[model samples]
Structures are given as structure tokens and as C-alpha cells.
Target: MYERTARESMCKFCKYVIKIYGNQYLRKPNLNDIQQLYEVHESKHGFPEMLGSLYCMHWEWFNCPTAWRGQYLRGDHRHPTVALEVVASQDLWIWHVYFGVACSNNNLNVLEQSPLFNDIESGVAPDYSFEIDGVKYKYGYYLVDGIYH
Candidate 1:
């Protein structure tokens, strides 16, 4: 069936992407990357314990399967959509990206299911610390749009 072919093709593409750029771009930040981002964001942006900005966007799924069309629909969007979430730096380095699964069929749903926090929960996330004014903080925070609020 068309669904099976499409699914297989997507899986192949994902594997190719991981093989090509996963090690350099998809991996978490290193000690130096952490240090520089922390310092610049603190001094320049006044966000002392900042990591990066997190955003989620919806992409219209015009070719969505007939059975799943209703699942991805929203009140505002006339068509079904899938979500793409990214965490990026001011310098435009995409620190994180999550997409593909139909389970995350909207921005808000994507946020809930996103693996962005998995590294931290698994205790393998890079360790970084920063002070704001005079108070020392343990964890970094992202600058998110009001939709997340």
C-alpha cells in the first residue's frame, strides 16, 4: 500500500539524516558550547541562566492518510498538520529538533511528547551553572514564546 511505502521512505530518510549529520549537529552541547552560550546570553541578553530559544511550528500535512486526517485538524487550520519543534541559539545553530511522528500532530501536542528533556531525565545532559545578579542557579532555562506559557 501507499502508506507502507511512504513509511519506509521516511524511515530511510531519517536514517540517512542521522548518518550524515547526527554526530555533529544532533548531539547535545559540549562543555565549551555550554560555557560560551551561557556567558553571551548572560551578558548580552540579560538572561543569566539561559540555554536557547524553543519553538514549535505546525506544517500542513496535505498528504496525510485518510483515516488520520481528523486527528491532526485544528479549529483555525483548514488542513491537517504535523508539528516541528526546534531549540535554537541566537547564532542560528539548531541545538535540537523533533518531528515526524503523527502522534505530535500539533504544536502543543509536540511539546508534551518532545524528547528535548529526555537527556536531562536520563542524567546524561551536560552540566552547566550560572549566577544571576547575586544568586547562583543550578539549571539553565530556555526563552520560549507565550504559547508555551
Candidate 2:
């Protein structure tokens, strides 16, 4: 069927892309990256220790399995869909990406399921400290819309 063939082609293309550019484009930020990110975001937004902007997008899953349709259906759309959560800098450099979440869920739900703060919780995150209006802060923050909790 056309669906099966399309799925296979997409999978193959994704594999090839990941094989070629995965490490450079998809990995988490290191210490140096964190420092630069903080500096750039702080200078532009007046928010010290800021990382980037957070947003979520929905992708219609036209090939979603019938059995899982109910779980992925968005209230606004009749089609089954999946969600992708991304955090990117002003330069459009993606720092974090979490995908495959059901579109039925809200941005907050996707965020809760994402491993965005795993390193922070495990105490392995890079050390970030900055002063905002003479107040010292140790953790980095992200610019998120009102939808986020």
C-alpha cells in the first residue's frame, strides 16, 4: 500500500539523516554551549541565565494505527496527531527536542513527559549562575508561552 511504502521511505530517510548529522545537530548542549547561550539570551532579553524559547508543535499522523487513533486525536482536528516540543535559541539552534507525544495532550502534558530537565534533576547539568537586578540566581530559565505551567 502507499501508506506502508511512504512510511518505509520516511524511516529510511530519517535513519540516513541521523547517521550523517546526529551528533553535531541533535545532542544536548555542553558547558561551553551553555555559557554562550546564557550570554546571548541575557544580552537580548535582559534575563540572565536564560537558555532559549520553548514551544510545541503538532504533526498530523496520517498513518497512525487505527487502534491508537483515539489516543492521538486532537480536539480541534479530526485527524490523529503527535506533538513535538522544542527549545531553540534566537539563531534557531535547537537545544532540546521531544517528540511522539499524543496531540490530545496539552503543551504542559508534553513538557511533563519530556526529559528536558533530566540532567538538572540528576545533578549533571552545567553550572549556571547570573545576577538579575542584583539578585543572584543559580539555575537557567527558558522563555515559554502562557500555555506552559
Candidate 3:
């Protein structure tokens, strides 16, 4: 009974937080935001039009339901988990976030499901052009590790 009550309280708190700060905290960066991010990242990382660093994190679900354990299990971990892919700048401002993916999936799989490139696909992305070593390049890019292709 205590566990049930705690779970309900947690759910209510989560919903309230989302309702109050969801738009500001949990949204993709717009054109102006992207431009600013590119400038900051480029000045610091020596990469023109660079947005931010991309990474994925796995969070263990200690209270995972028994029926869904197999689907969320990653391998040999003996626990169910969920993944969160994020693109965050040096200042810790999150530009992109994709969560709730099963741990069994890899970064590429999660990326495929993410809306990271949705603006590009919809032709609403801002124009990003910069000169590097006398070579003019267009389009901003994120600094992802070898895991992402």
C-alpha cells in the first residue's frame, strides 16, 4: 500500500512538473537557438556551425514490470532499462532529447526513432553556413561519438 501511494505521488509530481515547464524545458531548439548554439560550440570546439555533443544514457528501471522485462533487457545486465539520447551544449542546455527507448536498442536504433532531423525533413530548419579553412560549408552538425553514424 505504501509503495502504491508513493508511486501515485511520484506520477502526480512528474505530471505537474511537465505541465508547468514542459514547453520551455523539453523542446527542440528553434532557428535562433540553433544559431546561438552553433556560435558558442564553434568558438569553443574549433568547429564551425557545430551545435553540441550528442550522447545516449541508459537508466535502470528498478521497478520494471515482470512482463516487460525481456523487452527492456540489454544483455547480461539482469535488469530492465530505458535509454535517453540527448544533445547538450557546453553550458548544459539540452537542444535535443529522445527518451523512453528500450535498452535493447542501440544508439542508431534510438536515433532512427528520434526527431533530431525532423526540422530538416520538414524544410523548416534554419540556414547554417560557415567558412572553415577557406572552405564554405553549410548545415550545422553535432559532435557525436563513434557510436552514431
- Please provide TM-scores, in order, for all candidate models, with all chains considered together: 0.67, 0.72, 0.70
RMSD of each: 6.5, 5.9, 5.7
lDDT per residue as tens, model 1, 28-130: 7888888898888889898765778998777788898899987777777888877888889888888888874563355555665778766655767775455
For candidate 3, give the lDDT: 0.76
Q: Write the per-residue lDDT of candidate 2 for residues 30-147, one digit (tens) a residue.
A: 8788889889987988776777888888988899999999999978987898998888997999888889577878987777677876666677877655556654555444323522
**Where is model 1 more than 4 Å wrong at Cα?**
1-20, 100-109, 128-149
Once superposed on the true structure, which residue ranges of model 2 sit more than 4 Å away at CA? 1-16, 128-149
**lDDT, residue 70, model 1:** 79
Clashing pairs in 2: none
Q: What is the lDDT of residue 14 in candidate 3?
A: 98
Highest-scoring model, lDDT: 2
Q: Which candidate's TM-score is highest?
A: 2
| Reference-based TM-score, model 1 | 0.67
